[model samples]
Target: MELSDIRKEIDTIDEQLLPLFMKRMDCAKKVAEVKKRDGTPVFNPVREQEILDRISAKAGEYGGAARIVYNTIMSESRALQHSLLGAGKDLRQRISAAPKAPRRTTNVACLGGAGSYSHDVLQALYPQAEPSFFSRFSDIFRCVEQRQADLAVIPVENSSAGSVSEVYGLLMQYCFSIIAAKTLGVHHCLASRTGRIADIRCVRSKDIALMQCSQRLATLQLPLSEISSTSAAAELAEKDVGIAAVCSESAAQQHGLKILEPDIQNADNNATRFVVISKEMCIPDDAQKISLCFNVAHTTGSLNSVLSRFAAAGMNLTKIESRPIEGKDFEYDFYLDFTGNVHDPKVLELLCSLEDELPRFHFLGNYCEMK
Candidate 1:
């Protein structure tokens, strides 16, 4: 077919698709009503999978790739269906729900201004809470510790990269409790006002952002200068010539910088997990995770014997970190978390056992799952 003819045919098909979409949604509403009447679940993963498979098989008969069209249509259909009724209501019902919103005057602090990873995490995790930004991680920690901020989000570890050693050490030093935690994917970008990569000379960012973008920066072999934070880097690049920032998209937009490259981290699957800290323990109703720290005896198999109690109780440990006992020779403190709640008998038994085994220990706190 001629190009114009193909365009004409596509336009005609799009017009036809509008009515078909309406008709399909009408049918879905009927299905919702029927399910409601029968007290059946609104979302059925098995049925969704079947629908995708059936549509993909049928779409293959047409000109384009089956899976792509199938996924797009299925996602829209599922989303519409969910809106009509509710998505995954049964599972939500089973969950002991938490507070619907952040407490009044719930001030939160993290490492940056407006568009850093800490800011992004604050937005995603809270969505409704008021946030305060800081340049230093220690400042972020101090805000919560001193009651200047009600809570703080501090990065602890990454999947692609290893642990954030600074955050771990700070956690040990601070008297805050790990009230909540979550993981966010890190999507680094090389941003500058100048469009061309060759125009870039000095690169600026936080030490961590610089580390994350080390591979990309190494390729350029430019003089690397460290800034206080990613937001600070973006701020500098906004006013300076021949400079670029390794920062988030939001930061680039805020500072009127352009992204010369996206996802420039050394590891493709880079992610950083953060902990929500508070001076006083305050976990929501739907809390599923607990973090604790304790001092174990300076003896062989002491740590192992304590961990065995959790394993025996069928509790899964998410993390175990050890920090040196300063000024004390050969003594070590351990931080650990497992599946069961602090209120649960199994966990209580383990805690009691740990107290008996270890000289000293403290419960950091239990926290609600973010999502």
Candidate 2:
């Protein structure tokens, strides 16, 4: 047969499959009604696995491909059930009960001293708020938890270095909600009190900053030392002779150090994303994004099944990151960022189903995305 004839036949098959798919989805909706009446959860992993096994066995040579297709179909069916049954009604109500707008005046906590990137972003996000600086990331969380600060600004990820694994771990430990997020362009500079690169014998900065500027530091042949933050490094460089710091220009200027070399980072377009976390949940009117953390069962296809929930809802997943669960050998917790407001019925249903089905799940927050 000619290629065109084959294509026509495939099109005809698709037309026939459309009604059958709709019929299956209608049956799924009915199943959801019965489940709701019986107080049964929408997700049934054991049954899903059984169906997958049966279909794969029937497909024989095409078992792998068949499993993929059926998996997707099953996921869609679950999503339809969730929507029909209003899966996340409680969660949706909770989110809707939150304040419509964030407080105008608040106390904010951020890592590093004056003029640091965290400080700069915090200032931009909450200009009228009181700011407290901390030496450690955990300290920021502690301040918020203790009610000493109303919100905390944290560097969650760097575009060049990937996700800050330590920050993710801290997030898992803390019960704070992420109310907002911002990204700042990063430019590293080598600064010193001497105002000359020739007199510098050592360099100091945060470990991540030092790594970002490794190539330039190596070229200058200076020994690198890790400090609590770039702001602290600037302070050290200002007080000690024969020492230089790799930090933001603002930080160097704040500490009265002269810039010896600017834009020293290996990547020209380096940037870091910061999250504003608060003790109370607040969903703004313009909020269009959500962050989530979850852990799936250890069974086969468990992770895929969880992720399929999002795809089934037609939600766009902007980011998905995994961090090892503490003391759990090979187990991991996943962090997900997706584009959707919790107020959307479909999105809320998906979230509700995830909360019900996953071993562990957290709705980090619903917030606006700022670049």
Using lDDT as the measure, the top candidate is 2
lDDT of every predicted structure (CA atoms): 0.73, 0.87
Show the lowest summed lDDT stretch of 10 residues, model 2. 100-109
Candidate 2 per-residue C-alpha lDDT over 1-371 given as tens digits, one digit per residue, 9 for 90 to 100? 99999999999999999999999999998999899899998888889899999999999999988998898888888877877777666677778788965664478889888988999999998898888999998888888888888888999888887788888888878857889999999999999998987788899999889888888888887788999899999999989878899999999999999999999998999999999998888998789889999998877677887787777678899999898888898899999999998778777888887776678988899999899
lDDT of 2: 0.87
* Candidate 1 lDDT by residue in tens digits, 198-291: 8878999988778887888898989999877888899888887689999999999998998999999999888888888777655565568877
Worst 10 residues of 1 by lDDT: 89-98
**Clashing residue pairs, backbone N/CA/C < 3 A, model 2:** none
TM-score of each: 0.69, 0.95
Off by over 4 Å in 1: 1-105
Residue 317, candidate 1: Cα error in Å is 1.4
